[model samples]
Target: MQLRSALVTGAGRRIGREIAIALAQGGADVVLHAHTSSGDETRRAVQQHGRRAWVIRGDLSSRRNVQRIAREALEKTGKIDILINNAAVFFPTPISALTAQEWHTFRQTNISAPFFLSVLIGRQMYQQGQGKIIFLGDWSGRRPSRNFLPYCVSKAGVSALTQALAKAFAPHVQVNEVAPGPVLLPEDYGPEQQEELRTRTPLQRFGSPYDIARTVRFLVESGDFVTGASYVVDGGWLAQGHDGSGTSL
Candidate 1:
């Protein structure tokens, strides 16, 4: 089999890094996209797996930038067998304090950019006859969040977009989503918050970035028959339910 090629956005850190590296380990040449010029470690890690890794930096909030990154990925890798829409912006925005600017910013990065990029890549994949497109979603989309309203809504849009695209691009390209919950904590989160999240999960533990990455790999490598679906890798967070005590299984 010919080695596959993949384009993963926001692959410079955290979950994106894990997905990119996992794809490389699975014998896929990767086009790793980052917003800032800071992915040397990720690039090195991918290269260590004996796979070609190309770094492309662009702000996904802009349609032009999204197109540019997609074009460059195709140009650099010659073919894109998989596309992981892993780039996103998450911030707190209570309903009372939500601003138009915040809504636009969140939607631009989390929804619009990924939607357009998927359309563009789906077109290319349609021409090629086979491909996989995976969107990184969130558990909050299933369970709404008051503090992260914009972020949650944008992710909900992603879930809907995945199903829509799967129907639209059927028999040629597969479209699916991976929704994670508390897999990786943000830098500002304290230890108490982390423990609270783990307690809420049925597994009683937080998921690792690699947990989501491995699930993405399975979807790409073996999910050709699967589409218009979502796999929640939340350590049973959604299945357990989020009771006020943070302990419900």
Candidate 2:
């Protein structure tokens, strides 16, 4: 089935951009959300697929801003058939350096924003009788890297949120998550670190953004019986189990 319309957070670049474009390609008009970066590139990409596109800019860190984004998207599109919670902040927070402000930042942006957006839009979808919500999670959320404690914890909240929302919106709107692993390394990651992660993957390679986008497309376009499930697109890394290398995701 072709998706009517979708709101993709952080659609300005990386995996979010790819997901937006892929949804457009699959015949879904897209609502592109961007905060720090312009959504023009993704909007253009969506338009190239001959689907309608709208750019909504706002900071996900603020609940009011998130509410505004939902309101604006619904007003513009009439209704959103798909919602992709892909916007998040990732940074290393060493044990000794961790701060309350850091935890709050991660909680607000990574979890709180998505939670608000999900319930607000999710209720609408529930009332309408059909919709799909997909959250972009991290493999580290399951097997955390000690280096990014807050990030992992917030994402783990996402996993629980998915299950709760699925039950809340049950039998009407479908809710799920897609956890990606090593698809896009942080810009600050040095060559040795990058190589360590790449070689450690069971697939012996990194995944492309499209790998994640495609899984999202499946949940929206094809997975009618699927919900409350977390699909990990990590090149079999999760399956490898602890290789005793003490490798942290």
lDDT of each residue in 1-249, candidate 2, tens digit only: 446999999999999999999999899999999998889999999999999999999999998999999999999999998999999999888889899999999999999999999999998998888999999998778877778889999999999999999998999999999999889988888888888888888899999999999999999988889999999998887787642135534
lDDT of 1 at 44: 95
**Residue-level lDDT tens digits of model 1 in 24-77:** 999998999998858778999999999889899999999899989889988998
lDDT of each: 0.88, 0.91
User: What TM-score should be assigned to candidate 2?
Assistant: 0.96
Clashes of 1: 0
Model 2: CA > 4 A from native = 243-248
Q: Model 2: which residue pairs collide?
A: none
Model 1 segments more than 4 A misplaced: 1-3, 243-249
- TM-scores, in order shown? 0.95, 0.96
